[model samples]
Target: MSDKRSFIYMALVLSLITIATRATNNMVTTTLAPLGKYVFGFDNLLAGIIDAVVFLSTFISTSYINPTLQSSSRKKAFISANLIIFVLLGIFYLSNAVIIWIITGIAGIAFGLILPNLISSASLVDDKRTAERLLSLYSTSLSISLIIGPSLESYVLSMFGYKSVFLAFLPLGALAFGLSWYVKFPEVKRETHGMSAIKNKGFISSVLSITTYNVPFAALTAFLTIYAIEKFGVPKDLAYFSYIPFFTISFLTRLSMTIRPFNSLRYPLLISILITLIGLTGMVLSPSFYSFLIFMAILGIR
Candidate 1:
């Protein structure tokens, strides 16, 4: 019982860290349009480049850093990654356009460093059911942060302005960084890798399937606030909260998955893709704010 309790505690901490890191990352996307235009005097092209560079950096970092994360001390590496993010975010607030790119790029790398360790730590639970539940809760925690983080960004932008908003969230980052040092991570196992895994058709298909679902999801997250404002003439606050339907449904869907694990992944994936297509079509043809939100909710069912 004591060991199980400790594992649960570790899972919770890992979930909290996931929330902090992802929320911080989302805050960038949420504010990207306004911040780029208002603060940096950038046009869409420049803003897109700045935003794209973060994910590009993540890709580069993941290819190299993920294996290292798998091999190293998860606790120490996780703490260090958070520290790097904390430091870079602070610098990001003080930076100009070129400098902001540099800061955000490095922050993006740190963001990439977070996930493998978090999921690996959760997987340390000995029982398969418990581990699966923790992973679901872990995903749900991310949705909660998505709901909260942009809302907080909207609030801060409304009350404090852009730079102040970044400064305001620093304390939360500090808190996550401080609390991370106390969590106990499981022992690392050496990872085996080969081209053989990639050669498997099932492996390739699974990756493509996830990417298919994720591309639209990623686009929605990155641009939803701007899309809402431009399409509906809504205030930033309203635009930010427009995502509530999508994330709320997503959280509930993931919660349901935890309670009832998928019996077969293929059929569900197909159904989800169909639903997502309907949602995308609805968004393109949406006539009102409510309709678009309804579409977003539909999309979140996946």
Candidate 2:
């Protein structure tokens, strides 16, 4: 009973940390483009580049720095990463365009460290079923963050300027930092079959499928709100709401999959690809904001 109680407590802590950290991340990524364009008077291309810098730094950190720290203390790494992010959030309020780019890149490195640790912590359980459930819980937490983060930012943007979005997520970053200490990080054996795994057809296909969706998704995250404002001449707050339908539908689809996952990926993958193509086309040629949102929601079905 003690062991079960401990496991449950740890799981809850992990879920809470995931939600808080990922929500702050979502807020930053979704807001940066608009913040750059509107507040800093940047062109769309420059603003998009600023957003891309975050992911670029993240990729560098994940690929190079994270591997060196894998054998270190997960608890310490998690705490430190959260602290880095929380401090960066505070810095955003005083940042110019150049400062914003630099801060976001540093924050991305922290995220690269923190996220993999969360996944590692989730898999510490010996029970396969329990580990799978924990992984699903992690995904659901992320989906929930994606839905709520932008929606909350929209409300904040309605009353305040773009800088306020970063400050608004400060509390969440602090909460995630506080919870990082309670995380249970057990030593798990690392899998050394990466090269062999990459050779598999299933692996190749999965990579392709993920890339197909992620490419467009990443572009939209950086530019969607700006696109709405530019194309439809909507208020910044109303433009921010564009993410609501996209992320809400995404959350619902994720939750349904968690409850009843597909028996076969074949048909679902094919259908999702078709829907994505159609959604992209509709979004480009959308007659109005409502039609663009409808297509955005359609893309979320994947």
Candidate 3:
């Protein structure tokens, strides 16, 4: 196949696997909450801490997590993220212990490895403009997965055992492995421009804003399900399923704004910040299941 054809095919595969894994993250929190309580005997505060720690670790890892140099190295880093998730997921199936934190750390390491490469890989797959759209499609997959992940997870938990949901992700991980073989990740391009902010306002404020947004984002990823499971005491399945509505609403909102016949790159960065703030408020005050669902949906939109 031609390179263009390969790019398209790879984009589709990336979307499918990414959505599957992301959904697993959103939905699993609730199921694990009860397990943490009854099986591992954790209090709400402690469970929240466990949830918080994962993102905290992810934040720390982000700085160090560059894609490996060789194509094989990059592929290994990419697939290994899913592979690690697969293993930890299996561990979750067997035991509900403090080990989940270790698992979360492993998952975070995988996330760090996988996500940056997607950004870099997008540039390689096509020209810059096309790359953004491709990455957006990739993002869309996760959005769809976010929407579907919760619902699918919820269904699996309700229909089968909670343990089954963990198993559901293995296929996604395997698919990632299969697709990794086909990814002809082009050479890493070098930007001629240096990282100097010629038009910066203040050094301190820039640093503050850059770091602050990640706090809530990380916090939400870590604690949203825990909030639903522990604070609201929603059933594990229902909590897991909540991701569906969240993703659906958010994705629709994005599609509406983005997929117009006209091509517009207006105020996305500003809009994102506003959306995030709004979503963060919803998440923090999300005491009931409905509220958590709303917040997650808003987060998805943002």
**Clash counts for the predictions, in order:** 0, 0, 1
Clashing pairs in 1: none
* Predicted candidate 3 versus true structure: per-residue lDDT over 1-302, tens digit per residue: 98678767768766765666566655554455545665577887776676665655655544444422456666766776667766777777776575676776776666666655555555564367767777788767766876676666767777776667778766765665565555445554432212334244565655655655566655554455556666788766776565566568778876786676335434555676788888878777866778777777776665
Against the true structure, whose TM-score is highest?
2
Where model 1 places Cα greater than 4 Å from the true spot, the runs are 69-75, 184-197
Tens digits of per-residue lDDT for model 2 on 1-302?
Answer: 68788768867987899999989987888888888999999998988998898877877766566655544565677689899999999898889977887898998888887877788788888889888978888888888888778888989989999898889999999999999877767663453232455765678777878887888888998999899998999999899898888888988998898789899888888888888899889999999999998998988887
Q: Write the residue-wise lDDT of candidate 1 on 117-193 in tens digits.
A: 66666676678888877877778878888777867776776766667667777876886788668655665464433
RMSD of each: 2.6, 2.2, 4.6
Candidates in order have lDDT scores of 0.74, 0.84, 0.64
**Candidate 2: lDDT of 53?**
84
Comparing 1 and 3 by TM-score, which wins?
1
User: Candidates' TM-scores?
Assistant: 0.87, 0.93, 0.75
- Clash pairs detected, candidate 2: none
Please give the TM-score that candidate 2 achieves against the real structure.
0.93
Angstrom error at residue 144, model 3: 1.0
Ranking by TM-score: 2, 1, 3
Give the local distance difference test score of model 1: 0.74
Lowest summed-lDDT stretch of 10 residues in model 3?
189-198
